[model samples]
Target: MNPPAEPPSRAALQAAASQRLHPLSWLFLLLAQLRAFALPLLVLLFGGGRREDGIADLIGLLAAGLLALTAVWRYFTYHYGFLGQALVIRSGLLQRNLRLVPFDRVQNVTVHQNLLHRLFGVASVRLESAGGLGQAEAQMDVLRLDQARALEALVRQGAQRARAAAAASGEGPEAATPAEPAPVLWLHLPMRELVRLGLISNRGMLVVAALFAALSQAGDAVMKPLGNQLYAGLKEGESWAASLHLGPLAYGLASLLLLLGLLALVRALSVALAIVQFHDFRLLAGERELSVERGLLSRVRAHLPKRRVQAYTLHESLLHRWFGRRSLSVDRAALETGNEAAALRELVPLATPEAMDGMLQRLLPEGSWPPRHWQPLHPRAWRRVAFPGLLATLAASGLLVAWKGLPGLWLLLLLPLVVLRARIWARYSAWSLEGGVISVRQGWLDRHWRFAEVRKLHALELRQSPFDRRHGMASLHLDSLGAHPMAPPLRIPYLPVAEAVRLAAALRAGMPRDAGVSRARTAA
Candidate 1:
């Protein structure tokens, strides 16, 4: 029998040149670089009085040539790299930076080939860290889809081999078996939801339009003075009319309109870019983790391992309710640097309530499903959500009335006071808890369900105010594991004494191990 062929060495496999950027990519880079340097070069050339300075001209030429060459070298070094068991990147001129990413630590590898990339036979690869900390490690402007796919497969195989080796050397069964694959759950937002979510998003085209209008107007005001001063400086020997004559008001108006038009164009382009990046976005729920992929220019892939997710929430705004859409967010305290963990880890733009419920079941551990419908422990729980705000408003109104006469004071505060009272009342609506999960619902014009597993809870607090003590009632706040700065822990404002104790008992009992048992408990 012929001897078994030797496996290719990592260095041998990586010896071949991968791919090159399309010629157009170089042109695009050149234009962007030129724009960045143009103003500085102009300042150097024109800022000083006209002088026959051959030395300055030669110096400028040499600097421009050096800058251009440096840009080309940097791009080549960063983009070209070798793929192996550990990522081997060769970057920099004098001191090379080599990044070695072990396969087991790689959460997910995503490949994106846009229209331009397709035309050029190139793609970008994103490597998300499985450990769920720090920004994703990315390789951009790479060459060819096949190479990236091959690299991903190689890494996966190496990870499996590594695990097997570890197991043979006395690792536990859990170490041998990679975490269970996450359930392949998908939630799609209908077009109706897109419009509704976009409308209420508060950061839509209208805001962009208004911002552009303000920016354009401001830019014009700033530029006019600079332009006039420049003209005065340049034409010092010319007549006053030649140097300082302002355009006719009609002409100025036309120019303003043109500037506004340009601003609108730029704004629309930016919005289009953002929309495309978020367009047709899908979030996949897996048994082991949550995966996210989005964007066009720079594709992004994020993995939130089940162990990393601190909290899971479902929210319905007024617009969402109207359009049958719900927003789902997963919080991971591991992402502590970000301001709002909810914003960063939103599963999808829009999904139905049923879908949201299904996803919640999949993401949380066994027994962690929010009770769909249950009576609040306290009949006056609504009062808890609303009363404080109402009392504050009324007190403010009284103070104002005492200081000022009733004539305008009532006008100033009556409608607002009524609105506040109505809002507080609405917010107090209802909250409930059952089985493995706790549900807290509140909103004046919108509603939400925050579902968290007992296992997911970092800590719990039971609070009783003076009034609560008088009424023999208390409040429960459940703290989930994520990094949402603005999110208050789930608050159950009013719970009667007995029911509060019962709920606390169940929470402490811990979730049952069997999936069926957990479901049965929730049903019970």
Candidate 2:
């Protein structure tokens, strides 16, 4: 009998399966390069005024040609394939770099398809790992949409297998068995909720502010003329109103109406923006992963391994309260350095409090929201919170007395408001440590709740200011991987020094032994 054919070698299998990006990847790559250099090219083309140099035009053409050539070269050189449980990528034309990323290490896989990509039936794929240091570990600029989905599935299966193997070896948590249930549709935002989300967000104001800043920086030639026109128009309007002999009350009523109209416009813009950004939003919870798909013009599908979640935050703004909605977001350990628009940040953009509770229960069965008991801050914490405002008010009153005499003392009326704010904050601000999780609640007008599993804690800090020392108080701050930079910090301030130390010790002890939670003691 002929000898049994030997199993194919790993190298042979990998070489056989290695694949290049879509044939049109070069075009997409060229477009990306041009987009990056668009501003400079526009300046080079237009900054020359009416007198354009042939040399400059020729140089621009050469640069475009070079970019196209580079894109083509890169498309031909880059190759990716699966080698056992790892994804292997070979890239770089000159240096010839090889990178191997184990499936178990991938924290997130994102597939993005903008309007152009959708038209071409292609998408960009990004793999983010914890060790990427705020960068994507692997990125494929353009791939057939079907191929991208296939790759995502391969990674998911490979990661599941890795987890099973690790569990069998007693090195990781228990893996999901075949009996695990199907993925649950946790949340789906319809047009109504999307509208509510838009109404709750202040994105229109942010957009207007950004536009104003950009206009202000458009050089004196542009902004000076624009500002003069605006001023002259305002003067003309004022003269017109004066000619109408409108009383102060009528003028006030007109101003209020104008303000209301402007606010209505802003809200309309926000609603439109929200609809565009989060159209067809869906969140699905699988056995060990959470998947979110959203966007209208730029469709995005992102997968987050449930194990990588570091913390959770709930936001309730005044508008959200008015709409009976709250937003929930989670911080993941994945270090993502790609387009923020495509990031999987907001888990639930708008949900009723009851709906949010259900989500929290499903997401964290072992943990609870609005913990049974919250440890109140030191009773005198309000005094500390209000001291600065009180001092500022008194100083301003003094300054006013020095300048405008008795009229300056009118500012002293702000003191009551400042102290009332502090009292309200003290009443609401509290922390809770229970069931291996730490939760903090703060704010009066715009309430926020931040919580995280103890095992995910990265660092603990105890800070004491001179005033704190005098009052025998301390502040405990918690740090976790992938905490949102813009989110309110997970800090518990104005705790008795002894209680703070005890809580810190408890947190440190609860942290996983292998996590190596760091502790810092500082005086502020």
Which numbered prediction scores highest in TM-score against the true structure? 2
Report the lDDT tens digits of candidate 2 across residue range 262-369. Answer: 999999999998998899999899877888888899888888778788899999988889989999988877556554323467878889999998888766636566
Instruction: Estimate every model's Cα lDDT from 0 to 1.
Output: 0.59, 0.85
Shift of residue 83 alpha carbon in model 1, Å: 8.4
RMSD of 1: 10.4
Worst 10 residues of 1 by lDDT: 515-524
Range of the 10 consecutive residues with the lowest summed lDDT in candidate 2: 334-343
**Whole-model lDDT, model 1:** 0.59
TM-score of each: 0.64, 0.92
Best by lDDT: 2
